[model samples]
Target: MWKIICLLSAVNTAFAGVEKNFVNFGGFVCPREEKALGRCLRDALNTYIPQLATGVAEYGVPPCEPLLIPALSVHQTAGPFAVTSSYTDVTVQGPSTMRVKDVTVDSEQQEIVSKLYIPELKMKGNYKLSGQLLMLPIEGEGHFSGKYGDIDAVVTITLGRAARPSGPDALTCEALDVKFHIGHAALQLDNLFGGDGELGNAMNKFLNENWQKLSDELQAPLEEALREFLKPLADHAFGMLRADDVLGGP
Candidate 1:
């Protein structure tokens, strides 16, 4: 019975891998003066003093900055195979605009000029995110403004796929192991908002209350965008695989 139980456990384990990751990146960069300056960026960042406070009754404009923290590069890795990939020739096409209220503000865009590579197939690649901050205010009741800005990333994913069958001389796998790539993609966040004022204190309270709104604002679009991009790519990639040889079991 024990041997049978062990065998059943192994068979019940799911077989699939679908995930990604980002490698080392700068958490902050000072606003750029000229687009021509390729390697120029600000160094000083106050991670400790800052705190993020969002939506609540104690509300007004939350004090924040309109700037971007630049990420030097974007990379992904698979945990099982330690397959690493970096994108290149990244572009955030000129004079882009993310409209907020009546104000149409202009911002800078950047790209990864050359492809960065890592040979080791560590379970995952590390990433430092360039954060964008915009404080919201009550221009009026129903009409408020989003002090909004975003950083663009131009990257290409470099990973591999293989197909397998359940039989003698069958291929080993149709996908990478989940433990290797998807599960290992890591995420981190840092935001600060404080001023020695009543409004600032309110801002802190609001953030503590409605943090989900802010997180969703940042994450939802990204999730949707990724799904849009990946769906077709996945269809194209897996569509090429031979659909015969494996018996079905649900």
Candidate 2:
């Protein structure tokens, strides 16, 4: 029986897929399913597709921000314990001394800041989501007790289906059963033709190099340095997740 128990545990380790049994976002490390990347992705999908449903089912165009996941669950061992840091009270030289609201952690070039805006993350939304995270073979569960770095964020989107006209198309799209496939995007003939191929060459270069680059007016401008970039990006991303939950977007 002991040998069988050991074998069962080994088989559990071998399981491939997202594990939803995680206690807290902090303890993403210990669970087997949450530890694998593939499983993590599956977990995300399972959480998303269902939330878009509105009695009517649809396969094609799915709604955006369909899942609304809560950040903190009081009963769980896990924590949205967002911050657990060590800081010393010391005077700084920026032409004057002051109490710290933000400071640089010299240990790893990581600067942990207590920002002016910390959104009150509430635990309510039309849709709820919880999923596994893919941290690779890092040999432990996900980060714990904090350090959920900015990218590792919890996000939820809600879209209420007020446009239910009625048929299979509605059901298909509602169910999010629709999928998109990318074929070759045809280049415009007139634009591609040039005296010396200059236009084409330039277009090609732009496509190859600056595909992600956009006009500053089109999107947010890139900040000059690291410190300049951190606050705004973090605020827009994590800080907005739970600011207010009473009213959710459709």
Candidate 3:
């Protein structure tokens, strides 16, 4: 399991409305009305995607255009195919193009739910794996690349209050859950089985032919890794202000 710590580094610049005690970042004010809050939050997220992609240096937001993960390990022990794989120097592109189809924020429930769609996503990394895939012997250390299109994702965020010394309680991301489906995917692994061209070619062909099953087998661990990866970003963005400042009143 991956553990991520949420840290807030103070900055001189302010994005939240300090005097009004409401969310007013970049002129986008979140309405206090229950009926309108969800729409406002959705719009705000869509509007901020570009800025978030490039990152806000003053606010400590990291660039996400090509989100980088140094390393990730995934294991599938109880599936049609059991495998252990590790990926390093991973880069994922296309999140910045995500569109929110729907969103609901419930302050009382301390939860936020969103349905999102992405046109396409591209990933590249160095991978090492050892195990059986589709009952075929598999062992490799190589570079891998994948392209997925028409992705749909549902995300749920559970919020909690964090006590502050001088101010009202700030919001913290207690948990993040994500489930996603890919409409189509294409994958390739280089230098499979020590560069055995014939065997490697067959394996690659088999992988593509059975992409759906492979994706299913890997979904659980992949989603878990994604949730862990996004927690800090969520925390950093939400941790700067008190709960009321963002969702209490307009």
- Give the lowest summed-lDDT range of ten residues in model 3: 1-10
Q: For residue 111, what is the lDDT in candidate 1?
A: 18
Model 2 TM-score relative to the real fold? 0.18
My TM-score estimates for the predictions, one after another, are 0.20, 0.18, 0.81
The candidate that achieves the highest lDDT relative to the unseen native structure: 3
Tens digit per residue, CA lDDT, model 1, 14-55: 321110111111333322222211222111111211221121
Task: Name the top TM-score candidate.
Answer: 3
- Which candidate, 2 or 3, would have the higher TM-score against the true structure? 3
Candidate 1 ranges with C-alpha deviation above 4 Å: 1-214, 245-250
In model 3, the clashing pairs are none
| Candidate-wise lDDT, in order | 0.24, 0.22, 0.75
User: Model 3: per-residue lDDT, tens digit, 7-79?
Assistant: 2222212434345534554456665555566787688777766576788677687776677778878877666
- Let me know the TM-score candidate 1 reaches against the reference structure: 0.20
